[model samples]
Target chain A: MEVKEPKRRIPLVGILSGMISVASHLFRKPVTVQYPEVRPYEPERFRFRISLKLDDCVGCTLCEQVCPNGSIKMEKLVRENPRNKRMLYPDVNFGTCTVCRNCEEICPTTAIYLTHEFETARTKNSFLYSPLELAMDEKEVKK
Target chain B: MNDQWIELNIGPQHPSMHGVLRLKAKLDGEIIRELEPVIGYLHRNAEKLCEMGFYCDNLIYFDRMDYVGAMNMEVGYLEAAEKILGVPPPDRAKWIRVIIAELSRIAAHLVWAGAYGLDLGMLTPFFYCFAEREKILTIFTEACGSRQETNYMSIGGVYQDFNDKIIQEIKDFLETFPKRLEEIYNLYVKNDVFLSRTKGIGVLSKEVAIAYGVTGPMLRASGVEYDVRRAEPYLFYDKVNFEIPISHKGDNLARFLVRFEEMRQSLRIIKQGLEKLPEGPYFNPKAKKSMMIRLRGDGEYYARTESSKGEFGVYIVADGGVKPYRVRVRSPTFKNLSILPVLSKDVMLADMIAISGSIDLVFGEIDR
Candidate 1:
């Protein structure tokens, strides 16, 4: 149907929108992003990257995972302790971390806390590094 | 304490305002006698960003310019770079590009459909539109990592390949979901209120539309059937079949109808694309690393395509270098909005909102 211009100005548009906005808004799904309160839904095998703890000093390869996508690679590093003893650390390569956050969650110690930071895209493939070399390591420490 | 000729400012802060859009209206008792649109509020200097970043890094920035049409924006720069390098996408990659581009086009139009209804004072359609749009976005996020500003489209092909779940989701979206959009039209198109507010308001004639270079649904609304998809076929567009919906009224309502009909045609195009889905490699990685192909030193080529809203064109000059010498984008909203003062001149202060809403300017694009 062709719409002809009406000479009469209608005033109910704002009101109609207001009423409908309120009514349908009730039936509408809430897309609110609740941070620090609860974790939102995560799909299984949602691949991102992995984060590892440097303080726990355990060379555990448990993250080789109850396995799915072959994205996890754990490397062992030897660092001398304050007692002049050899301590073992796990170096994680994120080029392979499916970002299931499994490594951070399953670690047996309080030495690691995964920060809620994401979206670090870069031009270089080297930036996909998830090592202590990548996961916010302290260079200029409390010496 | 108001005069017969009331001067009202319909703000860079009003609700109906699309990202800092300001309108100064001269009204004679709710009827607008004159209105002016003020631009530059959301201007973030996106063009300058092009000059600052490397050709590869700049794609990320272009995605944010009019983030809604991120893929189109990415393609715009990639094509300009391709023109400079003189490397063409393989037939398989081109078809994949066209298919995903059309999907993004549909996604962008769904936003317009829902939001236009919101602007017209109907709210239910927005949710319905988003409900359907979410399905498309979900499919996008699954295929690409991000939901909105997906850097999914690489210079040659997609950044990633499609999985079985994504393919099935897209096919299901193509089939099961658009039924909700039908329910929305049935409920609102005949509501009388939506029609009375929108019909015959802000009529852009064919001559004016052509003169202003108004492409897309707005131009089609004036009975000028020129779609970049058909007029200048690129990618796999030549391989598929679709129709451009045109209306003769050229009024706000006519533009609305044009887009509604267009969604139908887009669905047809998507269906055709799926049935004829040929198998092959999505991306030709070799298209990226070759520094041998460079654009002509002194030639200028203008590429225009039918975006969800209107014709989006990119004009780039080659200094015979890898990156463009000078790039200026002719965004659809930037041009379609120029006719605002003409349309709003004799409208009511309240009606000015409807008029501007019909024009559908995105500040990201307008400011860029």
Candidate 2:
């Protein structure tokens, strides 16, 4: 029986090749998009924060049912709708939302949809958006 | 004179252990005498979660299982559901799914390349690999909204259609990615230090790999040409022309080379898919819009996709109900990780990391 040692090959050329290849990248522009300073453009269909179309609400409770994480809660409103006499609207807990867009796709009256506003950083969980804030935003947009 | 052996615990906490993998190795002067692996740290009861949700809702949970290759994970479950419901996706949808799945395969392999380099104390390749991966992730974000953990694929088809801009971006990626891949090969695979560390270490024989049920690059590197894409021919894989790279050595270096070639093959598939993409409705119009889809019949079915890690399989037993009666996920990482003890036996302690890195275990899938 013969015992053989694995052949040892010199790695000088290989090391030099790798070094040169990486060095070439230094001359190219950096790919980093500096956060907070520069906001990357969000696509049209991008699922970010959720928003409500207050006037179009039919109190379907479909968004609440479709949310996989139970992030949407429907509450009874004191003031009723002028046409449909609907009194229920949704309050969203943004903390648990996976942003899968199920609620948006499943909304019959198109009352709920994802907004382009993805930045939801807040100091407290209570500061997260509810139906009231969403309605206020919708009013401001209309004006 | 007396001989003594020391016991060492590698981690459920060590950074290089990949993810929550604990290895108990008995060492005799830096050479491992025995190795035992402990897993199940990141388990979130994936099967049980699947049973609770509607079939469509379970896609979100599958995304979390193999977080790196979420598209591939979703494909496994979607195929299973599609089979059970007797719903074949539209032709256009099938091509789109192939393109997205291959891009995900490239991204997942890039992660492995970066982490494997990190495990070997090389920092340059990690940065290089991630720089390319960022491009793929950006494309994913543009197409699917979320960059990671995207539940984009539904039972009937994809959630949305790719617009011209998205398709053009993919073309741009396809054009630029091959040169970047060559740069990666020069940076890591061709480097002598990498070859020295990985060339002949942790060799698994073809017979052993097959017996242990190791699929994907690991099995291919061991000289077994068992690719589920070629064998099972899912999606438009049969239409694409590509070769399965194989190495007879079955060592760490062979595994690295196999993945290196696999990235090229995935790029080839993407190019063909883009060229032959037809215009049609992305989703099946007859498919119901409800979140809870009710199955028409009660049956048991299994679907497997050739994921970047290995063969990811979903087995569902439906009792003609909205929720499945039983669901089981056969994760590739779990099977690949099982052979660690066999590969690590009698190897130097330093070589252990290389061997484990070659397997590319994602603990989220393994534990689940």
Candidate 3:
């Protein structure tokens, strides 16, 4: 049995091409985005942490209904409003959230939305927020 | 006989194995006499997860199966669900899907090229390849929110519309990538050392490639013109004008060249798709947002899409329920990796790495 050697290319040509390719990029600016210091820009529509506009929430329970990961649950509030006796609002568990933003999109009142604040790392599971806490924060902002 | 043959196990942990592929090879001196590939370390029961969830809920699982080509993975599932429901995506959505899928192809190939170089003892191409892939990932993050594992494509349409910013970034990438690709070609593809290492090593004949059911660039390298995009045109693939790159050599170098040409062709498809992108709703208005997306009737449907790796297919059986009765994924990497033993036969120990790298295995999909 005879073994045929593979066809060879000119080493000079290959060497020059490799050298030239590397040399051209040697002087160009680096493509690395310096994080922490530079804080890479996230798009406006980028889904990160879930946020709620408590005033606009109609207690529809749509966010909870559409959440595939079961991250959002509609819980009845202690203080019932006269306008609607069924006072339910969303409590979000960030641990279970895949951030698919299905809840945000399904919210008919546009009360539920995803903010670009992805820095949600914490030492405790207490980072999870209930609708009451969200509404309280809204009230504080208004004040 | 036992003393003459050395049994070598190459890893579920080795870096060059390209995911958790463990190769058990029987070596006689420096030459591999027999090689058996042991896979399934990264299996996450992706198909089973899909079966338990609604059609919309399965997109994330598809993303995990082939993390390098998440958009294409999502496309496979979406197409399967669309087939079962008898729903067609909007015109704008189809074009957007094509653009996203082709970008993913480029990204996957970039990773392959980089890692293949690394396997063959070249380092610079890895950085250059990743640098370009980062730009593509940035586009993905802007469009779909996540860099990797983007469950962007839905059954009715895509998750979000392609805004002007994302379109502009894609255009910028299209313009700058060719020059970078040329540098990659020069750095690794045309390098003397790379050529010596890869050229003519692990030759798979066209007949053997077909017999082993190899697809994607691997099959194309063996002179087969069978591309899922060209053979069975899906999405806007038929509308676009691009040639399926093929090589006759059927060697490691041939596979590399085929992928190199494919990147160029993908750029062309993206350019054409962008130019002809229609102005309309990105998602179909009729497609319901609820998790319980009931199929029209009880039926079995299969949808195959040309993923970056190869023909990624989704098979679904519906029993008139929101969740599928059974969901099966036909991953390209699985089919492609099956040919490794034949390719590795009688090859030198060092050449085995070259052979494996050329195939471009993603164990996540294979295991799934």
Find the candidate with the highest TM-score and give its number.
2
Listed per prediction, chain B TM-scores read 0.93, 0.97, 0.97
Pairs in steric clash, model 3? none
lDDT of 2 by residue, A1-143 (tens): 01112245565877887788878878988777798898765665667778887888888787777677788888877665774366888888877888887777777787787776766666554635667676665335333
Collision pairs in model 2: none
Q: For each candidate, what TM-score against the reference?
A: 0.75, 0.94, 0.91
DockQ of the two-chain complex in candidate 2: 0.34
Whichever of 1 and 2 has more TM-score, that candidate is 2
Q: Can you write out model 2's per-residue Cα lDDT over B49-157, one digit (the tens) per residue?
A: 8888777778888888888888999888988888887777899999999999999999999999999999898888888789899888888888878888878887788
Model 1: pairs clashing at backbone N, Cα or C within 3 Å: A48-A98, A49-A99, A71-A96, B32-B347, B32-B348, B84-B294, B84-B295
Better of 1 and 2 by DockQ: 2
Residue range with the least summed lDDT across 10 consecutive positions in model 3 chain B: B288-297
Residue-level lDDT of model 1, residues B309-367, one tens digit each, is 68887776666665556777878888888888887877776567777777766788888
Provide chain B's TM-score, model 2. 0.97
For candidate 3, write residues B1-368 as lDDT tens digits. 46899999999899798879999999999999999999878878877777776677777778888888788888888888888876789999999999999999999999999999889888888999999999999899899887888778877898889999999999999999998897787677556777788778999899998888788888888888888988888888899999888888889988898888899999999999999999998887666554334434359988888888888888889888777889999999999998888888998989999899988888778998
Q: Poorest 10 consecutive residues of model 2 chain B by lDDT?
A: B288-297
How big is the RMSD of model 3? 3.9
Task: Please tell me how candidate 3 rates in CAPRI terms.
Answer: acceptable
DockQ leader: 2
